[model samples]
Target chain A: MSRRVRDRKRLEGYLPPEGVPISFSIASIGARFGAQVLDIALTYGFIILLVYAMVTTGALPIEAMFALIMLCVFLIRVPYYILAELVWNGRTVGKRIVGIRVINAEGRRLTPHQIVARNLMKEVELFTPVTMVFTVDAMSGLGVLLTLVWVLAVLIVPLANRRRQRLGDMVAGTIVVDNPRNVLLPDLALSLPAQGSVPHVFDFLPAHLDIYGRFELQTLEKVLRDPVRGEEPPDFGQISRTIIRKIGYADPVRPGQERAFLNAFYRAQREHLETLRLFGNRREDKFHSAPGS
Target chain B: MTDAVAEQDKRRTGSSPDSPAAPAPQGELLRSARFRVEREGHWRRLDELVVRAEKAGPASLSYDETRELATTYRQAMNSLSVARDISLDRALLDYLETLCARAYLVVYAPQESIGGLTGRLLSIGIPQAVRRSALPLLIGFLAMVLGAVAGYVLFTGDPGWFYTFVPPDLADMRTPEASVDYLRSTIYGNDFDAAETLAAFSSYLFSHNTRIAILIFSLGIFLALPSFALTFYNGLVLGAFFGMFAVKGLGYDVFAWLSIHGVTELAAICIACAGGARLGLAVLLPGQRTRRDALREQAHDAVKLVILAALMLVAAAFIEGFLRQLVQDPKMRLAIGWGIGALWLAWLLLAGRSDEKQANEARGGSAP
Candidate 1:
């Protein structure tokens, strides 16, 4: 079941071998559409520039004219999306600006065949309907209907799933995700009897503190910040359990006091790490080295 | 030899100043804040290093800088997990998530062109796939021949069979009443408009036939019935045309006209049908695996067949438009048609085998 969840997100989560989860929020449809629009605009701009260049080279020999026309046909037919994603590490310029990236849906690296299949399918998904409209005068009624069906089939695909993946994403086994950004730590204030006033209520271990560092610290902070979604109940129990298992902590927190327990752990770990740093030693991850003399 | 720490020293100015009252001889809240503040410098420093690396490949990073980047990356990741578990600050969490995402991709995803996969596919993949589907291809070819024979026999017995099978627009000039002079001209015409008309005709055939090929391959998802019907219908049209010409005593002339491109064009159509049949069989009969697994296994070959069929149709269109026009003699057309048929057979059976051996040798050389 955990495997299914990981697969659904196209997550390359930290296994025993890999050592950490790779998580990113999937990009919503609006952002993807915006990038596509920018790409289309650029492609058209390029074609017009080529045409202008061809016209300026006046009286191009007959052979040159044929070559120019062929160039235009090639430009018109090929979408540069494949090349853009290939060269830009899964980002086109528009995608880079919008803070999204394409990745294989299976949590594997992108392959050339997948890239080609997805882009070529775009001809049927987007371009066929467009070209049909452009050549409407020549098409029979059945052809028009078929074109409409093709467009409809592709348009509804993104809406039918939580991932907001189009037919292209499904066929290519890829997903779009937000680019990573820098994390800030929130002001941590959960009202308990100030510091030592509640000393008997909980306990900590320096070794327990040693199990995590800044990376997991920020991730925990994000979870603690937003415990509830729009309608679903909060899942703090699972989150707490995962952290316990991940860090090899010996005991689970009291059932309902998951948040408070996590906060106490947070304070203990921070002080423990800061004390070490003061002694000219700074621990990083679970495998942090050498104790201060 | 090592100025990475010095480089990091110069960029340490970006950490927020107010964040640092954090020696934390005090409150739990104060400690977490100090945690954030103290670690903020590494995040900023790593981000700067990453920006440089992203701009100028990872190889450009100094040894110390690379170590710092790795150590800082792990630390940032830990901070993200901690922040999510304990903090309620949305902005901080968002920043952490984004930073982690960027860092993960830059660290893990390979940096290289994928040109080799495409090159391999074009050179060896399609032919090998075609070779594997030989039995299904033969079966599909037999089905089309059966359909053609049925259409020819039925049309010869009754002219209405031709009208029923062949669309009026396509059969416009090829009807029984078309003059011998006119029938001859379609194969060996000299008018200026003849070239233009043939060019338009070939493009129309290319799009129409290619569309059918793609549709047939995809429609195999529905137990392959539609694919069978479509292929049979295509054969029926050809048979009906031949049957009509036979009735008018122009069968030999018409055969010559068709032979030049028909062999390749028809073989392509049959391959597409076979691709669909192979898919149907996968879903209909799974020897040991689940049905879905069987379908998945067959899909690559099916896609290769679809793509190859489209390519052959394009080649056929060119042959039909230009070369067929030039070689209008009946014997020459038959020779060219049979020659192409033999070449396609030999190529499919033999071409990619050599490449397969070469690739295996290359892999062997690298393995040890």
Candidate 2:
């Protein structure tokens, strides 16, 4: 059971100084890559727009315009990252959209110092090599080789670790985790009865209810929740018969009434297991003998 | 039916049927229905508030809403813990966990005003950090000095070393073989387009120096060797340039020209390297703490130092762009350079000592 749980979402555990253990679902690399692409696209598009606006204005000589573009690029892009992360609490515009946010690995409040440290690293990792390629030596073999090596190192550093932290994140001790907006679904145990139909009731003797346990109850709950099938509606009749025979249920479940019967059985079996759980005799599945046997 | 058969097949091969014996709950069953019925309203309200807060900010909430947010967050945290213990509803646990996590992030975010933060960073943060890492700062300066001496010696021995020390484009007309008059003209040259060029020059200097400072700080993570080498190389370039002028007997003039800006710029470089060296040292000698812990602790101070250095570089660029050309007199230039340097020194030594002492006391009696 624990192995199955662990294989679900990869969780990074954080033990705060106050000793509260919090686990975050690590954002997938694909999602992070997508966010970066969006951010880069937006930043470059904005820079191009600014340059184009200035050029059309015809306000200065070519040399001056060139200098102004350089200044704008530095001023706009660098702060767009550092300031945006600071103000939005570790989320960039792209990060917000993609549902991932950076947090301190220690689970402490994100500090401005950390924000600046990480973003400055972006310059070293990405921008400097790019600038070198364009301005220093556009076509030199050595320059291209150097850039390729640097880029590869930057790319591989994250893949080398389980945390998916790039060089900046490692230095600053931050990690990006999925920040999803989730809604509490209505309780399955209560929903069917509230559909304006008469509440279906099923009574089972202790021996009949004691045949199953939590594991089987959970599987039954899954069936009750998702009745998805192709071409036609789910054949609840077959499921109801198998379950009825397994428990040697006494009631006659009509073909159309199987769902209602199943719902009642789920409620009763859950209640039985929960009661047994309270009595220190919790059953895991039907294969296990009842406690005290 | 097919799914059920597959599940039965898996069950036969799954964990052995002998269920592990363990203590179970001793009280009434915490039915998911009852729990949801009682708490669903609060969860929905919290969900609404968190959504609004995420879209805008926490400040977007009214006073009552803010109070409600806090109360509801605590209540949600309680719900999460309770659900973890008693409820087997995976969906409920997942929802509550996410809710509490979101609320925790929102509620515990730093609440400092921008004005207070900026004042603090300037008045004490930079100076205190510089004071703390004095050894690294000294080492950084010494490395530069050694490199400068090396460059001077090599250039004096062979004039060709000047070309090797300085980039060809930057050397322009300032070579050792250039006429002394031409060397003087480049320094005092205020042509008709001086204003136009100065604007570009200042921007270039600011961007270039800031980039170098950032690079030096970043490379400090790798044992500080790279940072030391870069700083030393910068010093070599400076020393070689000065050697070229000294050979022409215009050493004082060139010294004045450089000191006007180099005093601040070079100090800025040293500070940046100091930040990097501090990072390297943390990795080398973590002492009692783990290397990661040391790096994190020292990085806070290092970042402040580097940021201060970057800001100082901007100031230096402005002085170099305008004042160096306008103040042609070597003596006045020296006075301004030393004046700025002295002010920086005074600021570093004394800026926020009293304030820091009080903060230290408030934190827990004596300073570390």
Candidate 3:
């Protein structure tokens, strides 16, 4: 099974070194909605604070103050949303707290125009309907009906999709992903033999570690992790042989010792990179690093 | 058995001594032990640095530590790929993915400044985007005109059609049942307090029209159905009013009243609808790209158009509230309307293009 996955990876060598495609987990709708609500609350809170500051200090007349507050609710809302997303790399304070982020579905850097378009659409999606609801006397029945249709349509769109992208996300080529979490587990935990044997039994040159970098090291971590996990222990003999050849090891790997061989390589490579890293030299990739310091 | 197949079978069973299947192979175990002995330390060191960086921001690291962190990250990345090819542990693989994601965010994600963002959007971005989205814009404009023509025919042929087009509250004092004097009074407002009244009136108009245009732009996602209906209904109301005034022999009076702001207001509405239609078509047709991709591409233009239209609506509102009431003569109103309309057209179509041309020429001239 592992052999087949290896062959497939080699066939698609032009792809990124990790070989597997990275896909973001779509954020939950509840989280997304919560973030939006928080964002709106924050915006209102700021507006109230500003109004209070202005009024107490007698900075402007009451009529002008009233107009300014009204103006902020309407005109400044879109600018606020757009500016927040733009400055924070598609994160608003609300989103950051909720652990969700907006990203271009195309996997490229999001442009300013995309950000503006989506936030501007929020007027129809969220603000206008909300305004209509508040100003019931001012809005005609027809206007209210249209606002409902507009808001409902925008809301239903994301719910209808597997990706949970809102209307703005669809139009702007963006998706909200659950912000990735990194939990740092000790590196050599696996190297400690389960049977109480000494883990520090193997020894090799720094050059053995040089053959692999972070990309390969990560793949090694997965391979080592899989064996003790699932119901079926996958066959790794062909894969082990291939790695031994690739790394140019002279000794022939024993039949059952494939997993251990790979795990050892993982440990050695990780340690070598970290030690080299302690010095000034940086190895960005296989070709672009200072010669052994 | 062939050596590779034998190796493969041994691997499939169990590597441990307690395994049900055959396993006792010293050479493979020895080879594995030898490899682990050499490179384990480097991998562990990299992992420790990654842990620290992940726990705090990359900023928590010293200058030397940060440099080490980057190197460790790259090495770990390469190791992941090798491990995958070699069929190593799966836990190690998942951990590396986590590490890479953390590192990528710090290294690759760009946090832009607010001033830079505003400057880019204001400069050539909005206009150039609009110019590219010609097809949807044309469709959106035509839908509004189509509604207008239909509205005129329906309302002129049947006066009751006004009820269908204009809601009672929106129609206000401009009903056909109202006397000519009442309609005239409605347009002129209280002359005693014209300045303050007109300011309030224009603000109302601007907000009203701006909201409508914004609604049309946003609702375009429903395959542009709402946008079409909205612009069409607006046109219908206007057409019905025109038909009513014409019947009352106050056609010129109504024309003067509307002309000052109507030209810019109508054009903006039409433009906004066009933007909406682009969004709809991208969804409905999607062309060569995926539906989402097409919407995204069209949205860039549609959004720019919406922004432009909203601004025009404001200008029109100002004219309608202030200038429309002040400019009594039909000829003068028409002149002002035409001048503003032409200026907008020139700006949308030519402003950015000419600027780009000059920039290109300057670059060419500067070249050796």
Candidate 4:
């Protein structure tokens, strides 16, 4: 991958407390927006339900009602962001569901101070400006204009940066990143046919295996592993023909046996690359000349 | 076989005396298979632990499971490094990297107990931060004072200047046109049921002031000039309001009225601005350090001040809501205002002094 692309995707070279430099993908703006929308919906939905309940109960005097609602919103919304993040290690309910999380930009354990600072900043960057826009005296052009400007500025900040950090994130030195949970698949080489057991329909000799490298092997494995779909599956016949032609194999691959031919070639190529790696003759791609060749 | 094929095959699967797979050239794929077979148990175990931890908190793990997690994490890290060096399977390496990253996040997460965090925040963290950013605090305070003086002078000289300094919505009916008696009523006003409305008033004031404080602090990222400007403008509003009353010779009453909560509220604003000011100044002039480094370093204190200021605003809101209109005596108002101010000053200055050394050590221990 290109450095710029990798940098855009992953937070490179982050040293965790363990002192090992690791990297994680930066969450896409799309995911962040989705999480934010979910959060806003949930919080606002909650506040609406609460206000409805309070209004229906009539236990509170009309004069105190507004204040009670304000108190409820302030109490519920602020703590929901700050305390939830703290307890869940920078994940809110929406963030957890969306599979993204906030982390310290410096790769330290995220501090409570950072969490509070960032969330409070949301008051300015998002909540306040939005409320101001609605409540602004429409007659005063400047008031509406200023609110719009603030809203636009906040929106643009994240788009302009590689980290996709909004102003709050910048101030608090935090970034939102994808929470990955990839499972390790069994080694593909383990599926290779056993020696001296069921004679394979096709065999890949050393010459055929050596013609390809790790990259080609992986590409071929991907093709082989892809499940056949619909009436017209991938043209394994054409693919096998190309590989056979490229490797200068004299034998012909049977029409229906193309998949088996490719599978045999994949196993052989992977074995060849793994053996080369053990001997420190790692081949990155077809363009990467094998060691001593 | 062709000479080249035999030669390549022989070289590819070099001799291994202890031969299980090494005996046959085709069987040399055993290297990666063998590696996975040997260590798959640890990888699987670690994966299970991480999944469980993520689903629930680490507390869900048994003591033995926790110990196993540590060892498995180390082993995973080692495997990742070695795989990067020698493994040709990109999938395996990618899997290990992800595993290690997740494990690391869980393992080294800020494990500071909640009680310790709260104690430190109230005692050492907030006060030390306040003390460290004294320069910004002074600058913020002075900006407000200067703005207040400018506003007072301008409004006193020209009544028309009231429109220029204060927004109509904020000024409410406390305009130049209103009678002194009417303005006085606002200060001692209880037209609305005080007990019923005061709760709303307190919450409104709390949310509003907290929003402004947060805004000032966040705006500090833009070189702090905005923070200074915002603080000064607030001062202008106050000065002009006071000027209107001062013109009618109810200046002391107005001062007393505001002092009921103004001391805490205004101080909280200044402290919040100071948080922003420190942030702006650090970015503007990061001496001997990169701007990013300076910002990251200074942000700790700035955020602390903002949070502390926010809490202070909450208290100010309550006092203003409950007492400003209820307590009719000017002398009592002034005493209470100053009393609250004195307590805040004392707390900021002295609350964490006893544990200064201990606080530093505790903070250092928790920090990466």
Question: For every candidate, what share of the true interface contacts is present?
Answer: 0.18, 0.23, 0.23, 0.42
How accurate locally, in lDDT, is each candidate? Answer: 0.66, 0.76, 0.67, 0.79
- CA error at residue A214 for candidate 1, angstroms: 16
lDDT of 2 by residue, A1-293 (tens): 01112436667765433234456787888889888878888888888887788788987876577667667667755667878887888898899889899987766778787888888778777677667667655557876887788778878988888778887787788889898668776555655432214443456666778688777887787677755567455567888899889889886765566777776677667666655554467677777784664
Q: Encode model 4's per-residue lDDT on B1-368: one tens digit a residue.
A: 01211233343422222223223454354455555566778988999999898778788899999999999998888777666655656568778888988888778764334668988799888988898888999988987898899889999999888999899988888899999899988888777566778878888999888878888887887799999999999999888989999999899999999898999999999999999998899899999889877887788899899888888999999898888877899999999999999999998998778787787799899976
Clashes of each: 48, 0, 66, 1
Chain A TM-score for each of the predictions: 0.55, 0.76, 0.55, 0.82
Where does candidate 3 chain B have its weakest 10-residue lDDT segment? B1-10
**Segments in model 1 whose C-alpha atoms lie over 4 Å from true places:** A1-17, A31-101, A119-171, A179-293, B1-93, B111-114, B135-143, B161-172, B191-212, B276-295, B354-368
Write one digit per residue (lDDT tens) for candidate 3, span B6-57: 2322222112322212232444342223233344465567656655653454
Give the runs in model 3 whose Cα sits over 4 Å from its true position: A1-23, A45-62, A121-156, A183-293, B1-76, B79-96, B109-135, B150-160, B190-204, B320-322, B325-330, B354-368
Candidate structures ordered by TM-score, highest first: 4, 2, 3, 1
lDDT of 4 by residue, A1-293 (tens): 11234534756356654555678788899999898889889888988987888789988787678987787677665667998888888998899989999988776778887788778778777776777877987538888787778888888989998788887787678989899777776565555332333333455566666677777776776565535565455688789888888888877665666656665666557667766775678877776655665
2 against 4, candidate with superior TM-score: 4
Q: Give the clashing pairs for model 4.
A: A67-B200
What lDDT score is found at residue A252 in candidate 1? Answer: 47
- lDDT by residue for model 1 over A47-156, one digit each (tens)? 77766776787656444454445434444443367777777767877787787888766556666555645555565566656777788788799988876776677788
- The local lDDT score (0 to 100) that residue B148 gets in candidate 3 is 71
Best by lDDT: 4
Per-residue lDDT tens digits of candidate 1, residues B1-368?
11211122221111111222233333323334445665778777777877777666677898998888888888878777665544334465667766766666666664555577667776699888888787768766876888788889888888788788989998877676677777777757754235655565566567667766766665565466767877888889888888877777778877877878999898888888887777777778867878655765676677677778878888888788667877768899989887887987786777679877786799799966
Question: How is the predicted docking of candidate 1 categorized under the CAPRI scheme?
Answer: incorrect
